[model samples]
Target: MSTLSLPPRLLMGPGPINCYPRVLSAMATQLVGQYDPVMTGYMNEVMALYRRVFNTSNQHTVLIDGTSRAGIEAVLVSALEPGDCVLVPVFGRFGHLLAEICERAGAKVHTIEVPWGEVFDPQQIEEAVQRVRPKLLAIVQGDTSTTMLQPLAQLGEICRRYDVIFYSDATASIGGNAFDTDTWQLDAVSIGLQKCLGGPSGSAPITLSPRYVELVRKRHHVEAGIKDSHHHGASGSRIQSNYFDIPMILDYWGEERLNHHTEAASMLFCARECAITLLDEGKDAVIARHKLAGDAMLAGIQALGLQPFGNLQHKMNNVVGVTIPHDVDGEAIRHTLLHRFNIEIGTSFGPLKGKIWRIGTMGYNARQDAVLHTLQSLETVLRQQRGPITGTPGAGVDAALAVYDENRQ
Candidate 1:
């Protein structure tokens, strides 16, 4: 086999951005047996670390071994029994994903949709909840496909008033945006490390409120293969999927030391380091950094005389969508930026396909230097493709620098 050599790409796409160096290094550390004290110590520390990262005292915070979607599935499957009603407000592609997962888990899914770029108002959701009487309210905090951040601050109270459980998948907007798991009164929340945690996409961090914990524990079933004399079964239905059983996963992480699956040791180390890096830098400081980079990117795109997609007031701080000019070939521009400039941006999904381009400022790449470099490179490629510039030459870079300068003062 040939040596594995790849270009040093600057990932300005929506996710799977460049990971922090410390996280990569942490993954390379020597591994111990799964039951070793050192291994369990790291696991306990990771759970504690993510409690702070998620801004909750849920006491059941843990990492799911697969990608971000695994966290979403685990939460939905564990909470929803057959014929449970769930109301999903669809703003973009991932909202459909939540609804789909609920359906697969045998829920009677009810949905309300706005256009792709806009989000629901709290009153609209309240009306639906009153009419449908769903057992759960499922939503996504940020949908990277449309670069929109749904306003979730009010929905929790609506769910509480109706005795419906509140849950959100914050995979795309956790560290880069304002997410207060406790202050917002969310019963359950799930996130991945790849976006704003400055890590890869193999691990998911999840938190559950005491109310949610009591709900899942009702369906608890210890795997027969691993059950010992002290194990006791609950009267509720046994969870269908062994791997996604939250109670079993909790037992492994809890003082019981029950075995579910062989832990992904490397990914655990990576998850721990991601949380440590974010906490050490301070959560508020990291969010401000993402905001600065996102603001600069927006200013730069506007300076290029290109209109952005969606409502600016509700956009996320980590990604933006730019409208493709009718006269230019969007794919050709992306091709040139990738092959010639060693940069990577994102494309849209579903109804937005071929209509817009998505660019991201997230995690380790959320910095002034990365913003300026991507702006200048995109400006060069656009000028080359369309011929004859519109406004001042190098206006993109200059406008972005002005944003940084203003923030400095």
Candidate 2:
């Protein structure tokens, strides 16, 4: 195999936002066996850290050892019994993803779609629920596909009135937005550290209310052949994968001390550090940081004469979608930004492919320096990709700095 050498790039993309140095250092710490007391101690600490990060007292909070999608899939399969009805309100690609996962899990999925970059009002969802009356409602909180944030503050009350389980994929918003799991009455939530948590992608932090845990418990199962004090008894419905069973995972982390599978210890360290970083920053400050960065980015792009793609009021406070200029090669600009400027921004997916570029100011990168670097690199690349024109780089930076100055007073 060829040896790999990766150059440092300013990640101003939709995710994996330039990891914190402390998180990287934490991940580099010496590893221990999964069952080692020190390792399990760290694991328990990770759970506690995520609970604070999620602003929830739910006892079922834990980590899934995979990307954000893995947590999404696990929740779908574990919650939706076959033939159950699930309502998904789609405004972007990730919303469609929730429907797909629930469908594959055998739930009768019903989707209410709006144009990309738009969010469904709670009334629309309530109207749909009045018609289909789904048993569960699954949605993506902030879809990077359109850089739009779907509001859920009123959604949980609606679901509760109808006795529906409410679930959200908050991978794109967590740590960068104000989210309260208990106040929102979310039955379950799944998030990744990559987007706004300033860490590498691998572990997914998830929290579930007691109601969700109880539902998942119905479908729990035990692995067939393990011989240790860690092995546990089987439940009725036989969860499909031995690896994805949440109850067994809880048992391992709980007093039962059952060994479900080898936890990703290095990832657990990084996950813990990510949560601790958020807590240290103060969640409101973190959200405000993202808001300022996003505002600066949007202003910068607009000053360059590009139109942003999403509803101005509901955009995610970290990522923005800029419409690609007619004569410019969007991918070419992205390539130049990466190779020449050592900057990384992203292209969109599906309906937005080749039409819009997704720029992010997430996590550690959500600051003036990173935002200005992205703007400068973007300006240089856009000029190279499609002839230069006069634009006000200063205008955007000054506008953002003005906010900081005002806040200081």
Question: Each candidate's TM vs. the true structure?
Answer: 0.97, 0.94
lDDT per prediction?
Answer: 0.91, 0.85
Report the lDDT tens digits of candidate 1 across residue range 1-409: 9999999999998988999999999999998999999999999999999999999988999998999999999999998888999999999999999999999999999999999889899999999999999999999999999999999999989999999999999999999999999989999999998999999998889999999988888774646565432323454566678888888888889998888899999999999999999999999999999999999999999988988899999999999999988888889888888999999999899999988999999999999999999999999998888733456988988998999999999
Expressed as tens digits, the lDDT of each residue in 135-252 for candidate 2 is: 8999999999999999999999999999999999999998787788989989999999899899999998999899988777766454555332333224334556557677777787
Q: After best superposition, candidate 2 residue 142: deviation in angstroms?
A: 0.3
Model 2 superposed RMSD (Cα): 2.8
